[model samples]
Target: MSYRNTGTLFTVLVFLFATAGARAWAGSQSKLVAFTVDSVLAADTNKGIDVRIASMGARLRKVFSYTTYRLISRQRRRTQCGRMTGFDLPGGRILHVEPRTVVGDTIGMELVLFQGPRPVMTTELRLKRHAVLMIGGPHYEQGMLIIAITVDTPGSHDVLVHEPRIHQHQRLHAVSTPGQAP
Candidate 1:
């Protein structure tokens, strides 16, 4: 090959290598996840609301019609895409959350709510960046339980709480497997 052609080939190879590295970095970037588990109690009267979950009280009333909702626990974790992170929930249940990918401003995640060794609920979902996925009802206390999971971009403010943004999520990309993506 001519020297000129060799130089061109080297330049093209360099560009391709850089592009592949960038894509890998983007896929493996750390995701900041915020999860809140609330213990909700219902009553016959429209009397009480917990100040901690006051933001969610109205929504709870609208969806659940329960008299009260309290924030039992609020925790946040940072994990890479496809890595599993476990959260300790009320009633000794374990929640395993795995963040998969980001498409535009939306995030893809998988959740498994386990009681002891058996898996109770497992779902794969995607939601907008600012939205929170609330999984409610599983018998926690007198009433039930609500688990809210949020994954947002770094440097963003705390996500707001709304009436359980549990819309049908479309899978943007095929997952490798649980705990198996880079």
Candidate 2:
């Protein structure tokens, strides 16, 4: 083949390879969404936000207008799309998350907060991979509860160390603080 023909073929092959790589990455995106649920108590206890959520303290303060924000409990889970997953919050409430679809890099899901037998708040959310969403306003012991839901990075099913699987019955340690014994 001539040099011009060879150059044309090379350019075509490079374009094909790049397109294939992009498609492969999109195909490999998992159907799973990892959720990190943090239940925080917000009141005038003067403790401020806990270390785990201190990075978002400014947002919490501006929204909730509370003096203290303490993490009461945290739970993690990996749920599939079209399936509903529940997390137990303080004051005997349940926050249900149902992941629906992943379009591009955004994960869409529905969330429902249930108090006892009644459903309180039901809404849908679209979040980018690795973003945190906070939902609050449930009365608890001394203060209200602010629940933070963090969506892990896409295709992170392999690196989940502390998540509860929705399908299997596996035994795992409950989430604990740094200095506390598990």
Candidate 3:
């Protein structure tokens, strides 16, 4: 074969391989699940307490197609115990969560708050399927810092969100903290 023809054939072969490899890599990626994180501020009062939800509404409306608010009703609080799942947060903070065990409608999980990379505070939480799990701070401004996590699993609408509760009946497994000793 001529040199010019040989070069053209080689280029086409390389392009075919590259397309096949790209498809394989895309197929291997794990499907991502959607979840919501809300930060709220609460203050203690003589009557009881005053609660204020942070402005996640505007942001949610922009990012998500469907948005709704659901109040957290039943929650089981716990101290530091069990395995941990590390979640990277803003301002160089990390949130570690460990789901221990579940009983009936309640699911137990441990949370370890970290600044930079060090563990600052550790606590346990028991949450339901559609409950908001609140984590407050030692103190931020006049009110306490509260981080509310709502697990919004996709239902009939699958185009916008992916369901996180695919295997609800599966046993809870411990996830190792990223960039830390196991």
Candidate 4:
């Protein structure tokens, strides 16, 4: 083959090899976000030690592409996994609040409370984490609602809690699984 033709062929082969290697390396890169739950129970003070007594329910509407909802009844065996036991909701909607899996580093959730057709209230929450997030919630009373979330991380993490800038009650706290101090 002519020298020019041979040189052109070598350049094309080199470019192909470089492109393939780059793609293989990118595939091995760690996922941008991941999640996990603690096998051991959190400390009594860190857990939902019945600090408050209340009942709340919501109908799950598929806004995001992926979400899992489980109904949990207080009467059932209350344990770590049993957190999502059982109850009931109108229109056959799931009632229990269980651990959820949200892909990507940022998770967005919206909940609305309806009393027969008329909308009573709505809530919007955002979660951003590098690891997994163990969440439990939908607790409510009168017009007050609370969502408890436990984040899972093998390393010490700084969680950012965002509320209105004008609100003084906005704050962030950390706790760990039972036995371990945060």
* lDDT at 2, model 2: 100
Residue 35 shift from truth in candidate 3, angstroms: 5.8
lDDT order of candidates, best first?
2, 1, 3, 4
Per-model CA lDDT versus the true structure: 0.67, 0.74, 0.46, 0.32
Residue 122's lDDT in candidate 2: 93
Clash pairs of candidate 4?
35-132, 42-178, 71-86, 71-96, 72-85, 72-86, 72-96, 73-86
Question: Best candidate per TM-score, number?
Answer: 1
TM per candidate comes to: 0.70, 0.65, 0.37, 0.23
- The reply for model 4, stretches above 4 Å from the true place, is 1-48, 51-103, 129-182
Q: After superposition, how far is residue 64 of candidate 4 from its true place, in Å?
A: 31
Which parts of model 1 are misplaced by more than 4 Å? 1-11, 14-24, 36-47, 157-182
In terms of lDDT, the best-performing candidate is: 2
- Stretches of candidate 3 off by over 4 Å are 1-35, 39-83, 138-145, 151-182
For residue 136, model 1's alpha carbon misses the true position, in angstroms, by 1.9
Instruction: Tell how far residue 13 is off in model 3, in angstroms.
Output: 62
**Tens-digit per-residue lDDT, 130-152, candidate 2:** 45577766677887777878776
